[model samples]
Each structure stands twice: as C-alpha cells, then as structure tokens.
Target: MTIGATYLGDDRCDFSLWGPTLDQVTLEILTPEPQSHPLGQDDWGYWRTSLDNIPPGTRYQYRLNGDRLRPDPMSRFQPEGVHGPSAVVNQGDFSWQDEAWRGIPLEESIIYELHIGTFTAAGTFEAAISRLADLKALGITTIEIMPVAQFPGDRNWGYDGAYPFAVQNSYGGPDGLRSLVNAAHQAGLAVILDVVYNHFGPEGNYSRDFGPYFTDNYQTPWGGAINFDDAYSHGVRQFVIENALYWLREYHFDGLRLDAIHAIYDGGAKHILAELSDRLTQFNQTATYPRYLIAESDLNDVRIIRPRPDHGLGMDAQWSDDFHHSLHTLLTGEQQGYYEDFGSCQQLATAWRESFVYRWTYSPHRKRFHGSDTRDRPPSQFVICSQNHDQVGNRMLGERLSQLVSFDGLKLAAAATLLNPGIPLLFMGEEYGEDSPFLYFIDHQDADLVEAVRQGRKREFEAFHASGTPPDAASLETLKTSTLKWHKRDSGHHQILLNFYQYLIQRRNTNPAITTGDRQQIQTQYNNESRWFSVHQSQANHSIWAIFNFGETLIQSPPAPNQTWTKTLDSSESIWQGFGPTAPQTLKGSESIKIPPLTVVLYENS
Candidate 1:
C-alpha cells in the first residue's frame, strides 16, 4: 500500500497513513512554505490524500486527530534525527548501473560483516565505497552491512532502529546507502543488510499512537512483542512484510539478515517468519536476481531452514552460533554464559561434521535437551564465524579474538572458519587483526532511556563474571575507538595475518571439496586429550586436509595412511611469525608429522 509519501512527479505527491485507531489525520507540509491538507479515510482505516504543488524533498509530518504530530510509520528518509520531521525522497531519481548484477549464489558466498560507522572513520555509506576494492582483493564475495534503519543519534550498533523504513540521517540517509550498494555491485560483491524486526529501539518510536503495533500477550527481552497475531494485526503484518521487500526493491540489497528471530514471537497458523519468507519467494519468482533471507536464531532447530512445504519457516540460512561457541570455548577456555555448553574437542568435531554440537543433546547451561539434528540439511544452510559483533562487542571490554588468543591461535581460527563447508563470515578488521574494541554505543535524547541502556549493558555481562564496568555506550570516545585501524594492515604481524587470510580465502574459493558445500563428502576426527582435530574434504580425485593443534604443546598427527601429501600451508613457518617449519614439505604413508603449539596446517594430496 506504500504507506509513506509517494512522489507522483511533476510537483505532485500522495501521502498515506494507516491509522485505524485515530479519528482524523492532517498532513502538514513544513518545507517549501507551510501548507495543510486533511486526508480522507476509507473502510480499511487508511487515511490518504493527493496534493498538487507538493514536490520531492518536502518535509512533512502527520497531525493525528488534529493534536499529536508524528512522522510517517514508513518514512523513506529522515533527514533529521528520529525525533525530527520526515523528508520526501524520490527513489526513482537516482540512476543505477547494476542492472546486470544477478548476485552471487549463497553457496559461493564468502561474507564479510561490517558496521558502516566502524568500518571507516567517515561513518557514511558513500565513504565506505572507497574500501570495496580492498575487500574484493581479499576474495570477499559478499558484504553484510549492519542495519541502517534510523536509530537515535549518530553512533550505534544499529539494532535500535526506531524507523523501519527510513535510513539513518547520521549515516548520510538513503542516498548514501544507495550509492554504497551500487558501488558494491560494481565491485562484484553481493550486499546483505542486517535488519531487526523483533523490536524497535526504545526511543523515538511513535507507532503505538497510530495503531496496535505491539502485543502484551508475550514478552521479549526488550519489552512487548511485535503485534504479529494480536487484534488489528493485519496492518502491522503488512507494514513489516512490505518493509522487507522495500529494501530489496529500492536499495538493491541482495539479502537481509533477520536479527534475533527467537524473540519474534508469533502464535499464528502461519508464523511471521514463514510469511515473510513466502513473500520473498514470490518476489524472487519474477526478480532479475534472487534475494535471500537469513535468520539469526538461537533455537538451533532445523525447521527454521526446512522447505516451507514441509511445514517449516523456509529461511535460506541461519547463523549457527554453536560452531562459534564451540571454537571460542576451546581457544579461550572460558566456560561462562553459553560457553558453559561447549569447550570440548568432541563438540568442535560435531560442529564440523554435523553443523550442530547440541543436536538434541543435553545442555548444561540450559539444563535441558536443546536443538535438533540437521544431518539432512545442506552445509550452505548455516553461516559460521569465529568472531562477530555479538561475540566481540558484548564483552565488558569488547576484546577481539586477536586480543584473547595468540598470533598462531588467530591464524588457526581464521583457517577453521574459512576452510569449513559452512559459509564463512569475517568481522571487519579481523583480517589484519585490528585490536580496537567494537564497543556498543548509542545516542538517545531521553535521559531515562540512556540510563536504562547503560545499566542494561552492565547487567548483561554479569554471566561472564567480568570485573570492570563496560565502557560508556553513550561516549563519543567509545565510538571513535571502535573504528578500524586501516593503516595497521600493512604493519608487522598484522600484514602476515592478512596475507595468511588472503591465501586461505583464495584456496577456499578455488578448492572443489570446500566450495562444493556438500556435507556428505566431508569427515572430521578429533582427540580430546591430545587437543588436536582434523577435517578432510574430498571430491572426485581432489582432496584437502586441515589439521589443528588446540593444545599449547607440540603433537604428532598423521595426515592419512597409504597416500602421499604435500604441505600447502603451515602456520608454524617463519613466514607466519612461528618458531619455524619443522614438518617436512612432503609426507608418505604412516608418517607422523609434528604440529607446533596452537598452529593450523593445510595439506593437499599428491
């Protein structure tokens, strides 16, 4: 229904609002000289009006019941902050050069997740375009941008989006985002935008005044759940469903990463997640390039990715944190929070072989049997990463893997993620091992809301038994320090790590076994006492072996018996700042090789 101001060209525009609960709606044009127009309501509770002499870029707001003035629920652009007037934007005005881009397949994707504000000091979408070439050179095929939905203030993790449709004004608004997507397409990189549909930010959200946008029947960690099944939920459902399509259609985003689907409570016959996926499926039938919907769910249930016809949500893929948790606990030896459920060579091996360490097993952290088996699910249905925003930034100090693990351990983490069958995602600045903390930051005008957030961040880390208070989320210094240290990529150990990453990504892309994403052709073996693990992926006559030493001592491991092998990459070599390469370049049948402490070695059959 195009809920916001739709520019009709030639100085004419139409304004529409779904305010079923309100008696009257007045459209007040505040820019290009003030004007007022009373809108007419239909049987569906939709207030709409068409006006002449109304041009594009005009600022306007709706006066509900001739009293409370509010921005459009589906505002296309908020030139000012969330509390400011909404601006009219003609989406068709910009000429696009990515008509031929069909997007990369999900199986072929090597995702690089970045926060626009922290990826560069400029913190604008247009400013981020300058670095697309660097990412492409690193063999990254996809860039998953953190949410750009209009949140309060300029600095945030972007999960606190108040306006579902409007682009954040601090990040150069809609035009800036469009330019970045266009540039990314030109660079042969698919763009995936991280979106939050579970809850809106606490500040500057005005949807409640217009209609039943939230439900009290269920509670999320944030507050009330979104009204996906309550009374008068049709409009609310349409509002969010269309919002997902709007990004793919207007901004040219190749996909959307749905944040925290676990909190999106819906008790309807057709779940909201399934309904959204269905709409995307229909859109893709006629789309020039297929768009994807990836979910972030903690349920660890295979139904999230199963086909819709089989009574499932039908998501293209989901973030599998079990893999990350398994790897993190092993490397850092921290068994707090969800980490209590992991920290064993068997779990890591299970994640490598089955993509889920739990899979209906008992979880000591949850004190219940958690997760279901996904043995039949394809490996591409999961997205795995060693470090991401939640894993790094949620800490008291926001320490990155580079800060917690040794240099050799960092290399091993990179090898495990990049060489796995699941789609690998690298957090921004991890390639060169940027040590700057990606602390959570926000800017809200409400003093009470700000205090609540500050207190909440501290309480959240209590499970980790962290000592110091978290850095102030409202501090400009926190935001400034989170920005990637780009110049460090060419210096000392950072450059060495960066080179190692480049080589691994290149091999993953070209290697038949890893690139196939076929779980049936892979095998994993691990020894808990020795703290060594091996993953072997083979296709036809080609094979690759990735062996790891999680212990702090040297271990002897055989690559495979009765076959010759050549060392492709050894993290213990001097080139990687290791002690030196002690293992021979070539090996024969039944030969046990020495693997240095916390090192990763890759081998290809001769």
Candidate 2:
C-alpha cells in the first residue's frame, strides 16, 4: 500500500498517513473547495480516508494536532520546495520506451559518479539527458548520481535533502527524473541513485511532528540517529523500505548506493541495513530490470557485500576508501588526516592483494587496529575511485587530483584505478582533468544555519592544519564555481587526458585477465623507496604486464619472464601529453626498460 495519496480512478482518491502520537489529523486540500477532511487512525498508527472526484493537480498538506500544516512524508512532488504543500501527480501518464532494457550487473559496472547540479550548466535532469550518449561512448556502463532528493532552497550536494521520496524540484522533479531514467535505459546506461538513509537534513524536517522518526538513544554525525529498531519504529522502518521500493519500482532506478552505512547505527536484534537488504533481495527477484544495492561504509567489515546466506548484508558492492587512500597518498604524497595511515608502495600492494591495507592492522588515524581482510570476496565487490565528492568537496579548497599532482601523475592515477581488478568509479569532470573543484554547498534560507555551517567547516580543517576559509555555503558563487567546464573535452591537454582515460577503460575491458576478478591471476611487486611497481596478469596461457613509476626520476623496470614484448599502452608517450618515454620502443628479453617518472607502461608478452 502506498503511504501518500493514491488515486483509485473515476474521481475517487485515497489519502493515507502514519501518525501514532497525533490526536487529530486533517487533510487540508488546497483545491476543489479549499476544505479539510478528518482522517481516522488505525490501531497501527495509520490515518487514511477515501475521497471522491477530487480535482487533479490538487495541492494538499497535513495539519497535525491542530497546528502546523506539514508536507507529506511520502510526497511524490513538492513544487513549492520543502516547506510547501505536496502535489499529487498521475504516475501512469508517462510512456516508457525501454522495454528491452535489462540492467548491467555490478560486476560489469564501469561507474561514473556525477552531481546533477555541477554536471551541466542548466543542472536539470532534462539537461543531463543530453550527455548520456557521450558517456556511453566513453565506456561508462553505469552512471551513479549523487542524491537528487528534495532539499531546502535551490542548490545542495543532495545529502541535505529532507524528503527522500521527492525528487529535487530544482533538478526538474519527478517527471524530470523518470524521463532521464527512460532515456538512459534507451542509451544502454544503467542509473544508480545515491540515497541518504542515516539521518535527515538539519532544516524543515517535519517527520518528527507526525511520529518518532529519530532516536534519542543514539547520536550520528548528523545529530540524532534514525528511529530504526526503537519503540514504535516498525512504521518508521516501513517508511524507509517503501521509499526505497518507490525509487526502484516507480522510477526504475537500476541500483541504489546507500550513503554512509557506517552512520546508520542500529543496535537492534536485526539491524535495519540487514532488513533492508532482505527486502531489496526480495524486490530484485521479480523486478524487470536487475536491481542492486551498493553501500558506502568505512567499517571495513566484509559483511556489507557478503551473501545474505552467509549471515551478512547482501549488498552488491561498496565504495573502497582504503584503495583510494592508498593510491592518492602514493600519487600526491600528502599524508594528512586519514591519509596518515597510508603512504607507500607496500600499502598499495596490500590493497591490491587483500582489498584493505588496514585489515586488522594498526591504524595511525583511528588510533587502533581497523578493517578485516576481504580476500574471500571478489575484486568486483569493491568500487575504487581516485577522486570523489568526499575526497574533493570536504577539502578547504575542493581541489581535484589534477590540481594536486603532476601531469604524468594524472595518467598514472587513471591507469591504477581503471586497470585494477575492482570496479572503477570516475567522478564527473575527472575524465578530462577538469580544473574546477567540487565544493560542498547548500542553499538554506535560515541565516543561523548558514553561519553554523560556515563555522563548522572552518573547524574541520584545523586537524589537518589546512589554511584558508572555505567558500560560503550559502553563496550562489559557491555553486556556480563548482560547475564543470564541459568545453575541456575538445581542446589541448584536457582533450588528451580524456583520450587517455578512454584508452585505459578500453584496455581494462578487452583484457580477459583484467576483467576476471580472480586474485590468483594477478601478481604485484613493488619497491617503496623507488616508487615503482608492476602488476603481472595471466589467464588461459595469455599474459599482460603493467609497470608504474611514481617517482620524479628514471627507474629500471623488473625484467619480464619472456624477453620479447610489445607495447600496448604507455602513459609516458608524448601522444597522451606526458613527458617522452625513457624506455626503448621494443624489447627482446631481460632488458631493464627505462621507465620515466610518473608513467605507466603496459606490455603484452610474446
């Protein structure tokens, strides 16, 4: 049963709400007479009533306990923003065109992470649709968007969204999203939506007015924890479950990337995450398009993606910060904050072998041993990225790797991430080395909230001794500055970087040994002081070897088992806009190939 207004056809409509603490609930219709209908509550804390022939496009609000008209908790559309009344839209009007669309599995995903607001100048779903063809051509099988849930004002990172079911009105709302998804499927691109389930945004969240949606017993980074497994929390649990189903079944999202499961603290007998996983698995059983769940967690517990039958959460995959941290530290040599735990070829090699460098190892940042070895899991179960919203946006300047590392270093980062056995995730604008930063921004109307956000942001940088004030979150300039310069795709060094990224993806997909997530097929060796490494891969008697140098000077490569080899890809070649290669054009055996600084060379043995 739908939690909001459901039209039963022929001028008959049914409205339902879940409110246990309220003495009275009035449905204030803004059309067909501007009247109110009193709802009867059930023993299960549900308030609902049937109406006949209510006008279409009617705006409504729920007046609870005789005061404060609140928007629907399950509002499909909120045209007037978060504080406004929810509008009823017909869900059956749209004609979907992708009847043959079957979603790409997580193993085959070459995910591109993008924020709609910064992805295009217009920042609307309709505008985003124009770029799908280009992404498909760029070798992206899936596009994982940062959240689109309706937040306050016009601009946000979408994590501040207060309404989970409502699409951001600034980004073209419900129809906009549905149309985008339909167009994406037609282009053979799977859409994975990033969803926030841990905590609600700070402002204009009215779920507490209707019932207990937050818990006092636990605290999260965003204040109170969600009321999962608490007293009268079953209804709250249903609300979250239905909201997830709404996206997958109604909007046809191929998958969901659950935001920060580490913060989704629930100490119940059955954790909410495990319960949600069971429900999603059930939904996937009958769904036309294959549905998947990927979790973003820091708790290095392999249980997140482990099969449900193994008594673990049955998520398809998780974002691997350990992989990112190891790669980023090695590339840039910046050992600040969490990066303090990683900075050496050995750490990167550990991530390569076991998927977590800190797996039960002593962590300098956390001040304790963290993570567990995940060797039993396939490499595809981890999604690794060189840069993402968190790695860039949370910085004081929101600087990308392009700004932090050398030109050759950029290509090296691309090769390491894309060529890894794990799934590779590329942040928007990263393919072309877009110079603009992805800053954390918001458009809240509350002055007090804005000031508090500014002060809190400044304090966060003190731990790392980061200087300079972050751009004001409330300023429109902050949002405008974060927008991608799409023209970079057509010119100069930027165009070369784009081609380099495309080449990396092509090589990864074409190599059978690389595509198969088998750990035994890969061998990694490195020298921490020399800042050089090699990954030798083999499958079905075929073999390919990749050597990477991260130092600023020339280095000697490890000899190939077979002396004769042909160059497949080289980041140091002048064609990809890197410094000239230091190695010979062809090798006949046991030769020490001269590897240029910050370069990657892939050779196929004959």
Candidate 3:
C-alpha cells in the first residue's frame, strides 16, 4: 500500500509507506479536515502521493490495499495510542538552549542511572528535573535515564518499549523530555539516555504490518532478530540511525547507553555497531562537544571499547558486570546463579588488579572459558558500579545492596567503586542506602503475556532454589514492594551510608591518582592468607594507596618507603563504626597499619 502527500509553495507535505504486496494504497487525513487521496506505486512496491494544501499539524493514516487504515511505522509523534493516527511533527519546532554545551567525557563521568517511573512520585521527565540538583550535589556528572520510548501501559521499566520514535505520553511527551534535558544541562549534568535496538516489545509492536522489519535468520530471546542485513534492511537501519541522530541533534543529549548489545545479532560487511560509532564520531566533529556511546555487553569483548583503528566497535565505554558481581559476592557471600563463579578473596583481588574477574579463566558455572583480560585498555572504558537496575531488579524481590551487605561492607564497596580506575555509576538512592527494592515490575495489558512473565521468572530461579521461587510477576504486590522509602534516607543506618558516599565522592574528585584515566599506571598488592588487598594509583610522580580488608579480623600492612604518608580517609574510624581514630605513623622500612574488618583505608603519599 502507498501513502499520499501534497506540496505547496514554501510549505510541503508528503506521505510514503511500504506495502509492495498490496494492490492499492490510500491516505486518510484525519486532522484539519477529513479527506482521502489515492497513492501511486513505485517499482519497489512503495506507494506515495503529495497534497498541495496539507501542512504541519496534519494528522493522517494510511489504508492498506485501500482497506484498513493504520498509523505510520515511522511516526515521529504518537499523542494517542499505537492504533491512533500519525501526526505531522516538525522536528525544528522546539528551541534548544544547549548550543554551548559540550558533552561530558566518558572517563570523567560519574553516571547516575535511574528509572523515571520509580525516580519520583510523578514519574515524568519534568518531575525528574526537580531532583537533578540533588544528583549534581552528589557529584554526578551524567544522568543516564532509562528508556522513555512509548510502551503499552503507564508503568514499566521501559525494556518493553514498542514505539521507538514516540516518547511515552504518560511521561509528558516530547516537549517534557526537552525541558528535562535542558534543565539537567543548566545544573551542570549531562544526560545520557538508554536506548534498546535489539528487539521490539511483544505487545503493540506494529512494524511488521508495514514491511519486513524482522527476519528469521537469527533468533533472540525476545523473538526473531531485526532484519539488519536482509531485504529492505537499508531502510530499517536508516530508521534506527535517524532516531539516534534525532536525539543528539534535536534533543541535545550528551550520549547514549546502548542496552544489551549482545542480543543485537547482525552479520554484514560493516557491523551496525561500527557504523553507528562512526556516525557518532562524525557528529561529534561537526558538533561542539564530544558525544559518547556506552554499551551494555555481556560478551566481555574488549573490542567494544577498543579504538576503531584496532578493528573494534569503538564505543566510548562498556558496563563492567564482573566488578559488581565480584564485589556483591564478596560482601553478601551468596554463591548462586552467576555469583557461584565468585565470592573469594582472590576473585576480589583479581577484580582490583584487573577490571575483569574471569580474565580468560574457565567458569565452572558457564562450563566454559567466559572472559578475557582487559588490562591493555584504559580503565576509563569500563563503568563500574556496586549496584544497578538490573542487579537489583532482576532479583526474586528487588533488594538493594544494603539488604545483602553490612554497613561496613557497604562503605568498602563504595570506596572501591569510587576510587577505582574506571568511571563509577551509582544507582538511584544507593548513596543513602535506600532499603527499598527495585523489583521487576511490568503492567502489561495482555493477561496471557503477564502469565508468561510470571512463569518465566519462576523458571529462571528454579535452579537456585535457595532464594525460593520468586513471587508472581503479575502481582501488584511485587511492584509495590519495589518502591523506595524516601523517609529511610533521613534515618540512622541509611544516613550514615549517605555520608560515607558523599565523603568518598569528594575525596575521589580531589585525588588525582583516583581520577586518572590511564589503566596501566594502576598497581595492586594482596595477600591470600591475610584476605587483604592494597591498590596503588600513580599519575606521573604522584601516587596514592587504597587498602581493603575483606576478612573479619584486623590485619596490618607495610607502607611504601621514602614517602611522607598520611591517613587521608579511613573506614576503620569510630565515625564509620570502627574501633577508634587510626593515627598516621611515619614509615622507615616496614610501617604497620591496622585495617579493620570489612573496611577500606586511603593514604596519600607526598
């Protein structure tokens, strides 16, 4: 079926659609006035037409084979539901105020990852802006918002987004997004949006109705993979690439966190990742500030962060799940599922030495060699976090790190994450040890699909059995249990955790060694019997050491010689729940320093 359009002097309107198999196509204009126009077919089977009087703000739908009318697959705006008419949106209408805003560098970024629905009571883009000051005060350089694309319902984690181009109407639509981003920039924070390109959601996905948007060549957990290399794949790719550029050019976004790139299977001359990276680089050169791409990859392939000259995908950075797993397992001692591969002092030591835990070693849980070492790459290419959305929400019940580890352990984890070489990303409400869970919640309209989700969760955890079968995914109770208790942040234990985080962030920003981008300059020393590790970060001649005690008992470690070492930040003080003040003593040959259990200490050498 073809779509109709018309053009007038200084104002033009055109309609085009893909439906080669159909015999005829018709365009039904639903706004300004109701009218129908017959469309002409091209050699490739797409129908098109032009209307001389029609202009911007016109709403229309295309009739397939002159029969049933449907919304445009590439609709820029969807004020109504997916079944509603496509509106003509002028991308240039919104005025942006971030012309002088240069994007944040990947290495220096302190990312704050948040889901809008759960971030605030209002759960909209505008509401999120009100909280940007709090994030900025906490030293967050980038705001990584979860997906905002339109889904089937009002409540979702945004992984099930169906409309790639349209903003969720419940979240105050496109203009609301612009306002939030502009406000964030004014608050000295860059916005990095998380986008999913792997597959469309199961419900309300209508791309297939127009043309071959999916192919049977590859299968994903969601379903058939997107037709990246098949017939009409060029247009499909164009549609996605255009969407990406639209955000950068129109919305003034700083970067994008590509969601679960491993599932985006594609085999072509130029892989989609490489092409997208190249386009982003081109955009950066033309634009004022440099933009970045952060990939959420499970493959542990260093190529995701490697430079393009090395025949790599050239993403600015990638999320490091190994760091989180190692830290979480060490603190919680929960050895189930993937955590079965971790929880040893050696594992924590290895993660401290190298950013990866596996490092090409055999994983008994996976029954194979899982990952390779990323030592040669800069540490800035990896984003490390103690807790994040997936790690917390995927649990049977969304439980924050505070639930799994002690307060002392939480301090140690925060010290390790913030002072580490890689960029640090803090999950929302983690600074103050918010006790609320971030459970997997979805409000799907389809009853059968909801049942399938419930069964899927049960089956996923069936092997563990220790955590027991998770609660029904379809239950509203499960969703309610995930909401954060804002009152807890002002209380006893939670307030202490918050102070520790703030202090660590302040220390990290002031310490040159902690913020250095060069990975090769970082060194580590550990003792298997003592269950302790000390990291030395050196930039030029300046150096600082971070010591962590993983065992229950106290331990002593020698300090580096010929340096005036002072106790900069110690987690073993009475303020952090340790014994007393840890006095700094000068080192001659073997200086003894006591490290409290589950504590981290930082020393600056002059």
Candidate 4:
C-alpha cells in the first residue's frame, strides 16, 4: 500500500497508513490552525483519509489511540526532527536536468564513498554538490553516499535512521538530497546510497509499536531482526521493498549499497534479497539507465551474487573483506583480531587470484570452516578496497592507513588497490590522502543508551589492546573531528600521492588487461620472506606487469619475465619523493637491480 501523505491536487492530499494491530490512529494536521480528522479504518486495519483543506508543505502526524503523535514511518521530509511532525512535500514541484545523464556501468565504476555529514565543512547536500567536478576529474565514476535518512539528532553516521523514507532535516531534507543527486548526474557521476535494512536505530523507531515489523526469533547486534519469515511478514516485506523502490524512483539514486547483509536473517521460501533484486531488474529494464545493488556481507556465500536461475540470490556485487584484511595485514604486519589469519604475502597473492583467501578452509579468526569457492564468479562481482569506513572508523583510534604506514607504503596500497582485479572503492579524502580519522560518532538523547554505546565501543577493541582510551562516541566533537581537511590535498607528498593515484586509475581504464576484471587472466607470484609480489596480466595479445616491494631495506630484485620491457611507472622515482629514479636496466634472465627499499614499479612487456 502507498503510505505517507500524497499530494493529490490544489489544496488537497491523501493520507494513508497501515496498522494491522493498532486500535486507533487519527490524522492531525498542524497548519492554517490545528485540526483533527477521523481516518476511516479498512477491514485489513489500514487507516486513511482524503482531505481538501490540507495542501502541500503542510505539517501533519498520526495520533495513536489518544497518545502522543508519531512521525510517519514513510515520511518524505522530516523538516524538524524524528520526534516532531512530518512535512507534506509535493513530488512534482522540483525541476530536474539530468536528461542526458546515462548512469555509470558497474564494470567501469571507481566509487568514492563519502559521508554527507563529514565530507565538507558545510555538511549540506548543496555544499557537497559544488565539489562533484573535482571528483569527476579524479577518475571516480560513482559516488556512494552514506545513509541520509532522518535519525534522532543532527550528528550521526546515518546508520541510525528512524524514518525509512524521510531525508535528514540537518542535511537539508528531501529537496537538498535531490539537488545533490541531480548535480552528481550532471557531472558524469552515479550516486549510490548505503541503506540499512536489518534494523532501525534505537531512538525514535515506532515500527515495533505499530505492527510486527520486527521478529524476536532472531536478534541482531543493533536491534531486533526485521520480520521477513514470521507471521504478518507480507506487510513487513512490502515495507522494505517499497522503501528501496522509493529511493531509486523518487530520489533518482543510481544504486544502493546494502549495509551489513550478514546480519539480515531470513529463512523463508523466497529470500528477501532475491525478491529485492528481481524488483530492481524489473525497474532497470524500463528505466533510462541501469541501477545496481551491492551488498556488504561477511558470509562469503556465492549465492548472493549468482544468477537467479542457479538457485542463488541475484545481487549485482558484494564487498570483499578478505581483500582489505589481506592487504592490511600484509602491509602493516599487524597480527591481532581478524588480521591474525592473514599475514602472509602468499595470502595477498591468493586474494588477487581468487576473491576470497579462505574459501572452504579453516579460519583461525572465525574458528570454523567457512566460505564457498568463488573461482567461477566474475571478478567485477567483488568490490575491493584497502581503506574504508569500517576498517578505519571502527578502530579504537580511528586511524587511517596513512597514519599506520610509511609514505612509500601508502603508495604501494594505492597501486595494489587500483591495479587489482576488482571494482575499486576509495573513502572520502582518500584521493588526497586526507589524514583526519573516520571515527564512529552518534548523538543520542538517552543517558542509559549513551552509556551502553560508550561501553560497547570500548569492549569491541579490548582484544586489540588499544593504547589509549577511545573518545566518547556520544560527543558531537567526535563527529566534527572526522570532517575532511580539504587543504591537505594540494601540497607536499599529498599532492604527489594524489597525482600517482590518478595515474594508476587512468591506466586501469586504458589498459585492456586491467579493464577486463577476469581473474583467470592474471598470474601472481610472491615470497613471504622477501615481502614482495608480482602481478602479471595478459588478455587479447596484451600483457602488463606490476611488482610491489614491501620490505624496508633495499634487496636484490626478483627475476623479471624474459621479454622486451618498457618502464611505465616507478614509485621509486625522485618525483614521488623516493630515494632516486631507477635507471633503465637490462634483465638477461639472471640479472638483478638494486631497487628502492619500499616501492612499486609498473611495466609493459611485448
């Protein structure tokens, strides 16, 4: 059923809500003098009303059984706050100018994930729109926006969303988000929104009170698992499906990144993910441009992205934690937590050849036999990243890869990320090496909940034995500290790093072997003692090679392939602030060159 206030015509609106178990719900309009109207309830317990007095831009709420008014679950504009009345927005009022904007394809996507609250100082959609040209020129094809749905307060990471349909009031509400999407399309960039479907935030969530939106049978880390297989699940399923459609249809988002699909517990005859993908496919066939859906899952299950005909959930792609953890541990030599399972250079080599390193193998961190073999899957079906929000924000210190590694180490991470066989994703400020940490922050009102949050945040890092006490997550300063420092991008080593990243991305697009995203086309070799690896890619009579040295002291170079080799990019060049430029050398199968201590080099061989 179509919920929320839908503007019908001049000075008229149709308000509808679904409540199968609630006894009463009255429509309260708070404009042009307050008035209450009785909504007629249907046989299925849906309360609705058509009023000629209510017009667009009107503020209204539903009073439940003489209790306090509650904001609409599917509100389009929460101008005040989640606890306040919702606004009536006219869908057809705004002007759109993206007629010529065809969306970015998933194969060619270089996504830049950014939080609207911390991306810029202004922290508004309109302000963010001003910088799309910069990102478009930086070789990013897609911009993944963190959640913008209205939460409880002005400061949040956006995962604590309460209203599924409403835009956050602090982020300039619905019109602001539309403006950002339209601007992004005009700049030749596709916008992907990160959406949470497992559970709503602890504060201001009224779905449980209205109906069976949650199930007690399964518990999630955040809250009760959303009811997908339990009684009265049809409505619950419809609510989620409609919510996904609402973002794509109304907000004009090109894609959605499903957050924490691992926590979504559904055992029904038809999986909720498969149903969502089918609906997206139906829309993509008729839409102007293709829309994609990505999942952040830890299951390592091939069924999530496999074809529907193969009896698998038909998602477009999923994030690979193995790739990130593999790169992290190999680069830093840190063997704590999940990193305990992945310190070998051989594991990094395996992650590049296969999407997962521990497929059907015993995982020391998981303490169980985990994952299915994903050799048959396409490489583009996995999204790989060296640094992202979770890897950085969830840290006790919220330190980025920049803080933990040397300058040469940072360049190696960037080269491996771009040259690897998968879709690449960069966190905000990652392009320019923004050093500001991406800390976990929230602004909750309840003292008890806030204390619980602080305790939980510290407890998760106890195994790491963090050196310092973590900042209180409830502090608004924590949010402010995470904001990007735009000034750091144009000077010193940061500028050189930025230029090097742009060059790698350019090669990724122009090179045929790198562009193909086929794991079978890549041949990898590594040595754990030497701390070095080589990636050789060949396709359609074209071949290129890249070697990364993770060792600190200069060592004898590994044997180069017997061929006519031409230098493409040498990270040891003085231009990149390395020791010195590598002179052209002849490799007669047994020759060795004294290369820089820690660096990377790319070459083309004929």
TM-scores across all candidates? 0.98, 0.98, 0.93, 0.97
For lDDT, candidate 1 versus 3, the one ahead is 1
Give per-residue lDDT, candidate 4, residue 532.
Answer: 82
Itemize residue pairs with steric clashes in candidate 2: 11-53, 563-589
Candidate 3 Cα deviation (angstroms), residue 231: 2.9
Each model's total of backbone clashes = 0, 2, 7, 0
Residue ranges of candidate 1 with Cα displaced over 4 Å = 559-562
Q: After superposition, how far is residue 447 of candidate 4 from its true place, in Å?
A: 2.6
Q: Evaluate model 2: give its TM-score.
A: 0.98
Name the best candidate (by TM-score): 1
**lDDT tens digits, residue span 1-28, model 4:** 6777888778788888877888888888
Structural RMSD, model 2: 1.5
Whole-model Cα lDDT of every candidate shown, in order: 0.90, 0.87, 0.79, 0.86
True lDDT of residue 245, candidate 3: 75
Candidate 1 lDDT, 16-124, residue by residue in tens: 8988889989999999989988988988878998888877889999999989999887898888889889988888888899999999999889999999998999999
Give candidate 1's TM-score: 0.98
lDDT of 2: 0.87
Candidate order, lDDT descending: 1, 2, 4, 3
Tell me which of candidates 2 and 4 scores higher on lDDT. 2
Model 4, 146: alpha-carbon shift in Å?
Answer: 0.7
Candidate 1, residue 172: Cα displacement in angstroms equals: 0.7
Q: Per-prediction RMSD in angstroms?
A: 1.2, 1.5, 2.9, 1.7
TM-score of 3: 0.93
